[model samples]
Target: MADGASGLGDQARAEAYALPLEDLNPGDPELFRTDTHWPYFERLRAEAPVHWCKESEFGSYWSVTRYNDIMSVDTNHQVFSSGAALGGITIRDARPDLRRPSFIAMDPPKHDVQRKTVSPIVAPANLAVMEPIIRERAGRILDELPVGEVFNWVDRVSIELTTQMLATLFDFPFEERRRLTHWSDVATCLPMPGALCETEDARQAELMECLAVFTDLWNQRVNKPPAGDLVSMMAHSDATRDMTPDEYLGNIILLIVGGNDTTRNSISGGLYALNKFPAEYDKLRANPGLIPNMVPEIIRWQTPLAHMRRTALVDTEIAGQPIAKGDKVVMWYVSGNRDEAVIENPEAFRIDRERPRQHLSFGFGIHRCVGNRLAELQLKIVWEEILKRFRHIEVVAEPKRVRSSFVKGYEELPVVIHA
Candidate 1:
């Protein structure tokens, strides 16, 4: 639901403002599902940058809402741990027996080493190598679209491009590439009675199948020489080679979600945001060179993957608010991205900002997104290709957003291309 809807956004805004600061639960997935989470975050940022929620669906947690405060919390990894033992990165805590440790979810030493193993995939040389491939693939995807007919942009372009690239990264089977998308969604989704995933047990069942499939891939790759693909890299590298079965699955989920959701949603969000702010679209069409800047601006505007949660390793005070030991501290990147103190006109989707990249979307410090540059490159290439073929991509309807507050993304965006 877009803001300023007759009842939804205005009602949410009123409730958000009227609620006692301590009672506000911005992490509620329902708010995000309806796109009404904005005003709640806005209230927290303005009134309680370091607010405490005594209760939530996840549990009691501390919210660090401002830009600098989030930076402080994110960078100070020693004080705030991302260990799977404490709880993984998102607001949702996994069951004790199911806690799987990925590089992004581990503390230093192990986290550093495993992250380094796959870092080469997105290095400048690798990105340079992949640019032409991305551009060519993006062109083909766009070229095939019907000019006058409406289609779901999320499935047609966003999912197709990100999944294709993710398949290439993992050297996954081309025909079953959509499984990557499915697994990514399943990994971040909340298990509710009426939801896509009915229960935790059902979710685990699907994930086990993912592990089994990847296990086959791993077994096939282990005896071979070291290769460029992620599976081969993990199979060969000392840092990742001896990982436990659960650790292996954790890293696989991280890679799939990292490589799939962020870029995929941003691709859809860019078109949708531009459509929201038509002048920005006009500016982009007049000067396509603004794309490099526009890409990050869209990332900032979208703030895909809204928040990253960390468990307090020790007693710490964030912005003068005391956070006890073992407390969950959630850095609201979606809120921070809109912190007026840092970003001028934080709400507007402007393509030409003096410093468009100066926002906290991919995150900060040691745990920052490893594939951020790749995400930017994918978005840049798609838009570059899009501007070449289509005069406009008109939003046929309001996009269906993913329900989870963590993975801020689109489920579907209906649109018609004007060529």
Candidate 2:
């Protein structure tokens, strides 16, 4: 660990963190609002390390900003419970109490059982079998891009690519795949202003609409014979130990949101990064094998999903700060990845950095992202296809970022592809 203060030792730093959480404000723009996490975490990482702030809307909560502290909380599941907090994993609770719960919000042993149902479907081996399909779809999508013309890359490529892949995974009717996309959009895109309407009634209505579509799919999968795809795998995989229809629906919703949101974000974000740094793009084009290293660097730079919240189950101390029982503590992965204590010159994006893959975008410990390898695979293949097909890709318009803070994704990316 890079010492927070190189001039001092661990003992002095731990002593500073013993200060009260009330001294720091976690509800600031960087911490409270989801628009961006870096500014708030950077300050916390440097200042309080473990601090708390009160929010006008949500209650007061502790913010764990340092890399070591975030990793400590993430790995110590016994001390910090993922399920104890409201709405579970994410800090914001935009969904109505009656709304469905995804696996991200649930803690074991239910989380364990539900994850196992479809875990095999996304396992590395399964993804190896899935590579050709993803690559083929990726090729088809890239081939359709308007050469020598400007188009919105987010819709034309990123979103469509992930959505189509997901449709094939669930065996949904091609045209109807947009329905799955819509459900995921509303479910994860909540909390942002205009995401769900300002009114609770309006938000509930949107959620109900999303739920209706998922319910239809669940029934369809249940009634049909085994098809060897994900839906069938979830339906018949050890029913005695598997999720109930409700639980299955929730977990499926989780998978859709996880798969669509992050993968699409990486696609769009990587393009934006490459466009912003033409030198990096040139470097990548010169040596295509750099795609593997570049993929992790992109994930680290984008940090698609921001901080994940965990509640301290029993009173515990992280990096010497005492966390009370039931206190809401966030593992600010966004800050950790950029921590000066860990990554050297953390802010700059270097494609050929000796250790570009050291960051924690997929997370750490037992709850690390299950589809991590698949995400990386998609990134590498997408870049490979783009490099082969196009001589240059430039961003023609400022990319519109998603309103939600939880998912730092590009909502629209206008690009001109010159083949």
Candidate 3:
């Protein structure tokens, strides 16, 4: 467990320590919301790296907690399918009634073709084009921060910047950019009070609105010359151009959620992590050049999206644990990022770690995050711009974490920026 786990309530810590290893259910959303899930995952990694929970809110699922075990499952996508027809790439099974099919939840050949269609948007060439724009936005965001006053960094800085970048990617209307964030939230949120929606029906209706809006964009772009934007790329590519309405909507949700959550949360998480480890923040202040290397470390520490699930296509064993066909196998990237066997001093936040990118925050195999380089590029530029302007960004209160085991991120982070 990270040293920060010590900050958990004494009774909670005692309970975590006393609980039987088999009784440790790491999927509990309350643990994540309270930011006290570390001890549960710590116990899991120590006792049963490949453990099964007979039942839970999502249903029975197997958790692969350690680093190598997660790698084995993540790399072997053939054995552990990501198909929506099977169950999709989340612990929760896809609804048979409301099936939204996207490439990430697809098996290869089809997955490969569709993934290739949008690959160029985040390619090295496109990221190079995007760098200046990202830096400019980062600078403006930082410059506008209220000096020595409390503000929600998650909303003002993280969401705003990432949403702007998402707008640029899809050539979305700047005025209605918040809708992208709303749809992204609604897609992943578990439909609770204070969440994006309060019911499954509400989630679906908002997503349908998202589909309608994007469908208009698709119609407009499909008739024009091919351009560099993501919508344009999808409209022009033979592999993706002919997608059905549901498939198109699914892909849009996938791209929007992918574009919004990871980077936005990491932006917020990086600051929070630095504040939690003041020494690391001091190291960053002293040597700003570490920004490039530190970005991946932040991603590793944050492990933005906690886990990705795969349904077993056939009987398989992960680390000696037999997984029956159709069983849900969740590769807990959150745990793997902290596995002591793979990461040296996994608890501490160090800016100058060797092999910083050697983390599973991005999954392995063909389904590795397509926008990874773009994400890293955004973080690097933001940190660089922040260093130039601010002397320190202090976390004034505990962040209000999103109440979902899946999207491990902040809903709000109160901070005071010092120039």
> Cα lDDT of all candidates, in order?
0.93, 0.72, 0.90
lDDT per residue (tens digit) for residues 198-251 in model 2: 666665577667656656765677777766566777666663125554455566
> With candidate 1 superimposed using the best TM-score fit, by how many Å does residue 340's alpha carbon deviate from the native?
0.5
Model 3 lDDT tens row, 18-63: 9776677788788889888887778789888898888788888999
Given candidate 3, what's the lDDT at residue 155?
A: 95
Summed over model 2, clashes come to 1
lDDT top scorer: 1
Error of 2 at 329 (Å): 1.1
The worst-scoring run of ten residues by lDDT in candidate 1 lies at 1-10
Clashing pairs in 2: 34-405
Candidate 1 residues lying further than 4 Å off, grouped into runs, are 1-7
Deviating ranges (above 4 Å) for candidate 3:
1-10
Please list the residue runs of candidate 2 whose C-alpha ends up more than 4 Å from where it truly belongs after superposition.
1-37, 84-86, 94-96, 191-193, 196-198, 223-225, 239-246
Give candidate 1's TM-score: 0.98
- TM-score per prediction, in order, is 0.98, 0.87, 0.97
CA RMSD (A), model 2: 6.3
Error of 3 at 347 (Å): 1.0
